[model samples]
Target: MKKLFAMLLTVSLLMVSAGAASTQSSNWAQEAVWTAQEAGLVPETLNTSYDTAITRAEFCSLAASLYRIWEANGQLKDITPSSVSFTDCTDEDVLLCASIGVVNGVGDGRFAPDSPIQRQEAASMLHRLAALRTDYAGSTKNKMPHVFFDGENIRSWARSDVYWAYNSGVMTGTGDNAFDPTGQYTREQSIVTILRLYDASYAALPVPNTEAPYHAVLDYSGAGVSRMHLEDKDGNHLLTDFEDTDGYFYDITVFGDWVGLMWNDNANVALYQPATGKRIDGYIFDGIDEKNGVAWAWAYDDENALVVYADGTTGKKFIPKTVWSEGRAIVWANANTLAAIDKNGNTLWQYKTSFNQDTLVYGLGDRVVIEQDNTNTLLANGKLGTAQTYTIIPNKWSANYIGGDNGYYTLYDQNGKALTGSYANALDEVGQDIYCRWVSDTQYEYFHCAAGGNPTTLFTVTVTNGRPGVLPTDGAGVYALQTSQNTIACFDRFGTIIGTIQTPFTLDSLADITFENGCIRVTRMDIGADTSTQTMLYLPTGEPIA
Candidate 1:
């Protein structure tokens, strides 16, 4: 066996010697040339004159150009040159490897680029990308409490974050007692780790489709505050300074013994009575009701009816009670009244009311929902209509609307049509006819709109896995929204930062962020992060801390 191996080695060397031919350093060279004919690393004139295959020294000089690009931007922070110098390799080779974190040392401490990356080391790096910090300052436990698929083998030091990563789906176990924590994690494993850290669900809010960035102090008050009967607009009440509790406001409403709070976005808050539950912000309004530990209030309708003062109509006509549903506000004034109002407080349509003033009304989109005495019926033009009655007993109509989330303002409609033309998109976020942009991951390579523009440039990206829907930057332009690694970034048109929120979440499930005015709306998971107990947070455009 030994003789056969030696003979095979001898034949290999003989073949190499026989095939040794004059080296051609021209563009026509089959192998990669070190020349710069097509922006090659080496100058074509010099590289073409070589009589042999490019030597290690020549390759070093050829590749040194990349150093200049790095210098122009900033010092390579993560990449460091290998400690040990190789006799065969040039300075450029050592420096290039150092700058890219490929090789770190020499001799006993030398990092051999050709050597396989150890499984343990790979797992450690993977942990970093996943933002899993076992001894992190914010960490509550010294070791992770959860059991891993490969639980027993994880080192005590790495146990905390390792456990977090596995439970969060950032890392899957080997289905055994050892996660191979010391084992090399593959590229796929690393990507999955990054994806799981900040899952896509944090970026995507199902109810409101709001904008959410990682590490940003979101304003869940929009949903949570609304639950407390506090209603406000997208940008209202949210203190973007990371230090303050973003305030939330809700519309108080009542229907006899039943009262509930409604949110600015038209979602129902937990119901309770003002007389029973603890008062927040000095409860002083009518129609307060509490039930099942939830508190709510009955709001009053302050908006005046649209009285067509045109020729001679002068009496104050009761503007049907407007109730918000789905995304539009519906109202029914009299038996024959029907109308749809948009977010801008503009009336989309209005129909006549033929029944008496005492007739009870409900908001039914295409038709009128009328309740006379105890009898409920569908009123066409109001004469007798189809007879029907509602036993469920709907809540009474109140006209109190805070301006947005915090402030309330009364809206009076003009006796004119608001929707001059039909909307092409009934469900579009910005509206189908708005001619806005639909950005997938590809469209944002050159630029991404995190908040108020087309493409912002001046910012930093920490973790960019090239995922489909992760936010590119934190919401601040002044501080480069950087991932802990500074790998990915999102920018706007004027070269300002829009978003740079990072999380242990994936881009695939991230909620779409909605930037209304200057406020950003997004949802986050409450995974030990007390900040995201609610579904939505309203942060100011560049000020997300508060």
Candidate 2:
């Protein structure tokens, strides 16, 4: 099979080069260069500069040509991108590539058309092309992508696309066990990578639907009397049954299935599964936050004391420590007994240890992870594996990153299968399918990746002195991360940095950053005063809420 695949690839590259090129490329890329030229992927302007370094604009022109060829050959779905105009560049091909999402401009509305392109930047563009490929694993199962020797050099924001390029075989390294992520790339090298991306797009899946269901919140802003309304983006009523969602409610956040409804401030709260129009169950707390169909909150009275916890699924006193997508939740059956029980309060598995307060339990998709006695154990299928003292960060909606004793980690899907062959330095943080790894002493890599039975699309960035994380949240539209001591970068689901906010406080004082009801909620701590305050910035526009 490998031999056949290699032969087919060779034949594809060797097609239609009868007239040959007037200029030449490196000895290694001679054949690929001519093939790209004959296939109309190489323009006449670049025909003589095969050995020279490729500029950003020049590469986009090449990509645009390839895109046009694919569209003409009926290989791609016609995409009508929005009008893309750049201040520093008016190159038609570059603008065309940007319109179709093949590339992006530098900040401050400039295209930098004449600037040279880096190898990783080139891979990033190729990765974008991979997304449009018919066989791109957007909504399907994707086995792990490749791991490189210097993955840390790849920025967290570009990691997803870079890995996709590597995993899909659209890009290759400069030999000697390195991707040379920041190294310069010549025109011939760019052409070959683009050709690989072209070959893989033959089975391109339809562009992924970005507007999948996410939890939405409604805050009355204290106007109506304990009342709320639910509507879609177009202001169409989604839950008309709630003529008046009455209660002394502080706020309400509902998932699309409406199985998870978080409301607050009342003595008790009743959760209604709006889809079925049936009341699932209810509990009393200061507030309720749900994930993977399980709602949790702090005890109402004695806020600092841990007591009176109940099952998230049922109102029984199982005291759900953590819940996974699985039908079961790991609960504290009693003071000294930890157990996994179903919705009916039946124990499927139990761990008897004096770890009521010290232990931490987190969900990684349908799997459960237990941290007790300085060891971490993987729990699944009603069984617990032998505990090991390796660092582990559990992602409730995707794969888990388990670091070995060597301090290098491998990402594991729910099946406990390795997601990357090469290991990376793991950061003990979690988010909504978002993971960060230590890239260097001062730099951290952040990427949104979740793999269970399948994988979510990946987005990444590399930054220094930042990238600490958040416990998962249902805040869907935009995510904010403090990228540096005084800068918080905001990103969409695709992991694009839509905008950034310059913060006033130092990194040490920034306690937490979260998204609350479509705003960036930044929490800051005053150490001497022992007080914490939260500030909100509106989303998309990042305007101060006040």
Candidate 3:
């Protein structure tokens, strides 16, 4: 990469110096000088000094050039230059920079353009250049903890921009985590900083649609500050800097083109269009299910009326504690009785349970699995049925199988008849036809049990990670498993390894993973520090999506 930069620099110098006379000898800033000249950022007619301190006018000229490049490349748009009336500097570059809010003059209509530029001031200008791009508009300028030993010396207004430059790898401290904010910046240092800023912005270009099948929303919070970002599958950030003011305890659910943000603390939910970063509407919701495209919550000032939002329509009925199914039904438990309601607020059926104990209801296709205190009961379409008592209520998947924590698994038919063979532990169901069962510490068995037919072992996998979980499918039957080694192994129902991806970080460093719309959103963190650093990645390719 350095060699490429050198070659580009040489070409740029040759093009810009075509009809101009060279004034300075080759120096340490030869490459940077060439780059500035080639991009039309610095005037070739001036006698450039590579070791002298950079002036405000020179820095503004460089900033204006970078901004123009971004605008020409389609990364920025609709930037109207400001008409600033500065007393000292009448240079077009300085006026352009000031107009775009990248630079500000001293008070009383005077811009000390000939004064030496400070490090913190330069950082602020570079940050403004970055903000011109739409993808970074949501980023917040939170105070960074322990980033620099001399952070207190930085000007109050420039602290956030300086921290942003430091964290984004565009700038570095002098030594021992000390940022000399008040020091005069040299011409060489100015060029290097500009190059770094240019590289960071260039890498943020949007990914083409054909290569990225999905986008991700990453939530990062630390040191009492939180933010959210949206990025594409190939790791280019689409939106950034969204502040999570309330907290980080929220759920991100995607339906069609919209992403729903459900905060746990409050009943209000926010629906956002990720493509545009616009909040469609905020609604009070207790729970939401994408399969039925419905949000359930108690109406304002009327806790008895259950407000439901589905298909862009709102309906209300007096129902409490509703459990939504994947199909077009909502089931609720009320006074020892379970009732099934359709989408139009019509009650389809109701069944009274034998035991009046407090029960938890879970929908399994057409069957309802109820955990009434210690007894687990399966009711078919709201019909009263027998209950089985277990130490722990078993987890049900695909409606045909229920796995318990007591080292016993059961597979039942549509009529509730138990099939033969005592499977030990069931991990999860793959698609609609296959169930993954744990055979030993490292081995898992995939059974082809369509409609609870005679179980047939389709394939067995010896995973490196003892614990494996199912990944979201890519519309096809192909699924993936994330192992303890932070590796994702993709396979079909037949257990064929179609592809494998090794994550950039370790499994223990992973904070969370959200699988949505055939894409996996992963959050990795460096937890043991004064300030935690959280990074987000888009997998199977393990690229930085945000």
| lDDT per residue (tens digit) for residues 1-546 in model 3 | 556766865665567654452434256557655555555555442335556788998887778777877888898856777678887779998898888998888999999988998899988988888778866652432223223445435655675577677766666777644679899887666766676667665222222224433344557757654444445567666433444533233455544445555553445466555565666445444555444455554443443434355434556565453444332343445666666665556777777766443456655334566676577666665554456664222223344545354777666653445654666765466654556778888788766565546777756766554555654654334455555456665444434444565667775534455554334555566666465655444433233334
> What 10-residue stretch in candidate 3 is worst by lDDT?
202-211
Cα lDDT tens digits, model 1, 1-546, are: 545544663464346543453323223332222112222234332323343333223332333443343445453344434444554334656456444443344466343434434334444443443232222232332122343333323443344455445444445555422356556443223222333333333221112223421111223445345323222334343222211222333444432222333444543333333333422221222211111111111223443332221111222223445333222344543456566543333466666656554556654222345666766544322222444332211211111000111221111111111112111211011111111121343222223222222322232222234422423222211112233331222233233333455433333223334443223444434445453533333332222333
Model 1 has an lDDT value of 0.33
Q: Rate the local accuracy (lDDT) of all candidates.
A: 0.33, 0.57, 0.58
User: Among these predicted structures, which one has the highest TM-score?
Assistant: 3
Could you tell me every candidate's TM-score relative to the true structure? 0.20, 0.36, 0.41
lDDT of 3: 0.58
Residue pairs with colliding backbones in model 3 are 82-99, 138-241, 139-241
Tens-digit lDDT track of model 2 for 40-149 = 68787886657788999999888888888777777775567879898898999998889988888888899999999888888778767656645456421122223344
Model 1 is weakest, by summed lDDT over 10 consecutive residues, at 426-435
